[model samples]
Target chain A: MGELLLMKGNEAIGEAAIRAGCQAYFAYPITPQNELGEYLARRMPEESRVFLQAESEVAAINMVYGAAGAGARAMTSSSSPGISLKQEGISYIAAAELPCVIVNMVRGGPGLGSIQPAQSDYFQATKGGGHGDYRLIVFGPSTIQELVDLTGLAFELADKYRNPVMILGDGALGQMMEPVEFPAMDEVTLPLKPWATTGMKGRPQNVINSLHLDPEDLDRHNAHLQEKYRAIARQEVRYELENQDADYFLVAYGTTARVARNAMHKAQGEGHRVGLIRPVTLWPFPDAAFAKVLDRARAFLTVEMSAGQMVEDVRLAVNGRAPVHFYGRTGGVIPSQQEIYEALIKIIQGGEKA
Target chain B: MTILVGAFGSGKTEIALNLALRMAAEGNVSLVDLDVVTPYFRSRDQKEALARHGVRVITPEPRVAQADLPSIPSGMEKVLGSEEGKVIIDVGGDTMGARVLGSLRRLLPRRHSLLFVVNPFRPFTATVEKTVTELRRIEDTVHLRVTGLIANSNLGPRTTWETLLTGHEKVLAAGRQLKLPVIFGTYPCFLNGNGVRSNLDLPLMPLQLFMFPP
Candidate 1:
């Protein structure tokens, strides 16, 4: 085991990126997620890594694209509004098949809503925020430890798939402190990037462009991307099932999943057969993990800090086999354990007749 | 019972919250959120949770709690003057934030301790010279000499035993330069049985994660 340090989720992600052999970090300051850029600003100079506070979120993400295109492990972080500005650059990176990490320390927003944490970006993340047919392997970690572990994993996944990866979190996660042990720097092994546009010293020139002028060639590229997505879905579906034998199940991800865990234990203390299904990988959806509890669960309650984003995925996973209910608190409000427990009991009781 | 002052992002709020929770076990504890610099990550954000543990939190009135502007409630003097329980003031980040303490300095107990929390990983305080500069600025702004220093060197999740020791060394250097006592050094409790132990003779504050899980 490595050394344990108390860390906010944002700082954890920053350090994990460094340990994972990231060479460059580019970001524009935004509330909630600024700690990450600040952390890197101090450490990157010491480590002799590239750290740039870009002119804007757009410039920051484009800098990430430029760095990743040249085969350096690169990352950028932002909140909701800043993230929106990066979508065009993100699309270019995705289309170019560049490997990089983008962290969204999400804040509440349809516009500039609130600076507090919210999971409303679920659709923007998993369903592709940028234009064109593309996908980002999204990881939603509920614990600070997972934040560290998954950040390292996100880097490796991006490299292995030659695709962009997003670590989706919120203000609560970004700001909250927890104890985390980072993997040793020497222990992390990065894969070879043969396609990197480093130099053409003795080989043919490598072109790193997302633009495909031919319609048939674009269709083929899209088809290849879809194939890669299918392979990722089959290989990277990650979720955790707690008290799988219970009659009631709560489905959640990220910070909301942590809250639901506490609520599940409380409901169990009340003699209610309640369990939790926490999705660690939001993009792959982890639909098959629901199958383990499907036979015994009377109903599924989808809880979130958003209106009803992941609930749609849960319903599709259940596929009319059982009832799916949703409870959410938006605009940066986090629901309490008592509220989630009560909602579960109400669903279990009312669900018997339905 | 204590006043924690430091540069922004130095983990003072977390330390104050932990100290308040610890002190609450002994007697009634009141936490005053004097942080007016940053809108988020204030002790006031955890008011309800702290209240559940019997820690009285004196924050701005409900009408202005959400506002970005500084609005110190008038009740601050009353709470600072109360004789019933220990009081912890979580001053905002930097000398600018410490300036708020100038107005309430006269009300503070004569023997109260003002702890300068030093996290070497933070940009402004990374060097011994920079840390001393910030310390002097806070002391000047608050009109109170720092009685002690608390070493809180960490790199968030990427922190190692070496990280803490490196920070402690910087604090020790700063302490020698400033002629202040290095009162305590902190390490995350997760390292309790991890074969890494502090070599410093100073008291160790084993920090706990008080924030809600991410």
Candidate 2:
């Protein structure tokens, strides 16, 4: 540990990116995530790094594209509505294989939703919010420590695969304060980007573009991208299993997982067999981990801050081997521990539909 | 007994909620939510939980809780004037938030302590100079000087023992420059059994989460 500090999730992401050797940050102010840009705005000048309060989310993400194309560790952060505006740029970044980090401190949303925390952007993040069939490597961290750790990992993964990675969080995580130890600056080592467009002084010029007019060329490019995605899915499916011996399990991610853990413990205290499976990576879905639980758990309840997004992935993983049920609080409503515990008990007793 | 004031996202509401719960264990305690700046994460949001623990909460009426304009409840003066027990005022973030306190300054007891909760993690109070600037602005707006400083530095869930100490040092330095006493330090209660421990001799306020989970 380099130094311990009590930091908000938003501020921690900013500090983690800086310590991870991120050289450029561009973002427009939005609720629950404005602190990130504000933090970098104050620190970047002191560190002699690039920090810009872009005119809009669209411009900010495009700036990320420009910086990533120039071979610099770059990032942009926003909440749900702001993220919607950047989808076009995100697709372009993904198509061009520009390494960058984008943080979505999600709030309730369909249109201009409440500024309170919600996981309603599950599909947008995991299924690709932009046009075309691109996927963002999404990491859903339950704790602030995980947020810090995963933020660093997101940058490295973005660089490693030359693909954009996202750190998904909600208003609760972003605004809440927690104790964190940032990695020592010397501890982080980044791979050299040989394909970076650094003026091409003594080598062939590197052209970075997402527009390939030829259908055959586009097909081949997408095939290569799909291969990379498959490799990532095979290698980076992270999840946490608690009380695996229990007959009933709850599936959740991000802040919902924190509450689910509490609910699981409560159910256990009552002599009921209940466990939790928390997916750390939302995109990879952790289907294999869910499969391991299928044999042991009689039923799985998917709890989320959204209506029922990740539950679809859970159902696909369970595949009728076990009953898959969903319980959610949408539009900025967070479910309570007691509520989840009761729901699990209802499911276990066969009183509720699964 | 105390008035907690600080910059936005300084964790004052969390500290206030915890302090109210602690005080309620000993005597009748009332928590006043004077935050009119941010609609979310206000102390009033935990009214039911606090009331269950015998802590009286005075906040804006339900019909106007989310209103953008600052509307101090009429019941607030009665609670502030009561001679029965301890009272905690959780002022909103920044000098603008502190402006609400100006109207209630006359009702505050002379012996009450005005604590400036310093969370170095917040961008506005990240440095000693910036912290001092915020403190002065709050003092100016509320027309009351902060009697002491409380280092409540934290990074939401990423806070560690070192985070508190690092913030403590900067807060202590700021207090010395401002000729104010460093009163106490705070750490989240969740870290109690964790390997990290606070070495600061100052009194510790083990903050509890009052905000709803995301």
Candidate 3:
């Protein structure tokens, strides 16, 4: 029988990957997450799984790429800079349309930003961490629940769509301890990866490549990706929230969302009508869902650790129907519920019109 | 150079391992174990092993640093003069073990780095000032300036984000008083003793496991 254990967001992601039937894992050591690697390194060996503590994040990501091409459940993880090194490979994986999961336990950014909890990577994860016309099915885990749940979803969606899925987290989620339950997956096996690189000796070879020398072929590939993206956009938008009897909505995700939820309750008891609308799938953007809620009556505020990155998304979602407002503090700093509620109340009462 | 300090069962080894691996990423680095007091997961335990990644662990030559007592080793003075590469020094838990560094004042680097691995939720959190005073006193005696802090606060497997945040504020302010940077922070994981470390990147050092039950 599989055992139940308490884990941080990082460790949960590692365990979830294992349960998703991923046997090959590679990564370099980074903060807030060494426990994840060490846990897997120590345990996987007993299961006869492949776990390599590569030289660098770069090496680790490429190792995942190689394994994914073989049609296996493969994954890698890193923080800001380390993830930066792996972006080139991430884009390549997307271009090839290969299935894999990339976990980014986000920290502060823009060149060695302080390693603290931050949601600044919202854009990086949803808009494609690296360069290219691609999008990662990004899932922002606000609690250990999402860390385990979304991690499994990341693998499933990546395989279902033959694209990369990202588990966007922060230092808080990765470092903080929590009681978590891991479910068994033997009763629910994922479909076999017939598109793998497990070798094509006796049968027709399966080529996994992102390159196209011919202009027509490249155009066709681009068109195919566009069509697939559109399909994903239509079917994959996801979000979560507690629409309590409140006029003001708090938009946030990842660990910040949980903080916002607590902050909302505290604000509510103080006689403020505040609720939360947290995004679970950031890449799909959940535009329709949020836009539909624009009729709920009042200003919407985006609170984050970054300087109004995701607020732009909120603004785009609300369009002109409701006035979109924002407040943020970055570089490992988080705003308090009082601060968020104050901002929300200020926006609602400020009478600033769109 | 980096300095490691923390309490018993506070995740110092994890932090050291994270720091050592970070050093190994770029070029050559060294993890010198000054903790003759601890039983397992000492810098000495994994020093030679770091060579696999270009990091070299500095061991005491004359074995003066080999003593289990809370005293300084003669070899450290020699280490300060050499400008070979990055170095991480792991010290014992308290002022007693930290007292040994008084003799190695000439060895501590300037502006490069130093860290006081703090797990604030432990028995030390009774008073913020008390903890700060003790840490500062240790720094004063060691002659090593603490340039940064690594909050490895936890409540064993029951630790929560709130506990981490609560402890972080105190330790962070303490480190801030010395104008030291809080480079990154670490939290405890509930993985079985055999589970993986963690997946977040924050220029961190995870907890070290004691092999001999010290």
Task: Identify the candidate with maximal DockQ.
Answer: 2
| Tens-digit lDDT string for candidate 3 (A166-248) | 88888778765555666685744767877787878787888888889999998999899889888888988888757644677
Q: Across residues A239-306, which tens digit of lDDT does each residue of candidate 1 receive? A: 89888899989999999998899999998888998888999999999998788878877899999999
lDDT by residue (B1-214, candidate 2, tens digit) is 7999998778888889988999999989999999876657788888999999999999889877754457886687688777889999999887768998987899877789999999887667879999998899899999998999988877666667776677878888898899999888887777773655656566776777767444
Model 1 chain A worst lDDT run, 10 consecutive residues: A345-354
Model 3 CAPRI rating = incorrect
Error in Å for residue B1 of model 2: 10
Number of clashing residue pairs, candidate 3: 28
Better of 1 and 3 by lDDT: 1
- lDDT (Cα, 0-100) at A287 in candidate 2: 91
RMSD of each: 5.6, 4.7, 15.0
Instruction: Please give the range of 10 consecutive residues that has the lowest summed lDDT in model 3 chain B.
Output: B205-214
lDDT of 1 by residue, B47-118 (tens): 999999899998888887865667886688788877778999999987768999987899887878999999
Fnat for the candidates in order = 0.28, 0.47, 0.07
Off by over 4 Å in 1: A351-354, B1-3, B7-11, B14-32, B36-39, B46-64, B67-89, B93-114, B118-145, B150-178, B182-214
**DockQ head-to-head 1 vs 3, winner:** 1
Candidate 2: tens digits of C-alpha lDDT, residues A1-354: 764566778888998998899999997987778678767987789889999989999999999999999999999999999999999999999999999999999998888878788999999999999999788999999888899999999999999999999999998899776767788877788788889998978999899999999999999999999999999999988999888788999999999999999999888999998888999999888998877777778999999999899999999889889889899998888899989998898988889877
Off by over 4 Å in 2: B1-3, B7-9, B14-39, B47-89, B94-114, B119-145, B151-174, B182-214
C-alpha DockQ of every model: 0.26, 0.36, 0.06
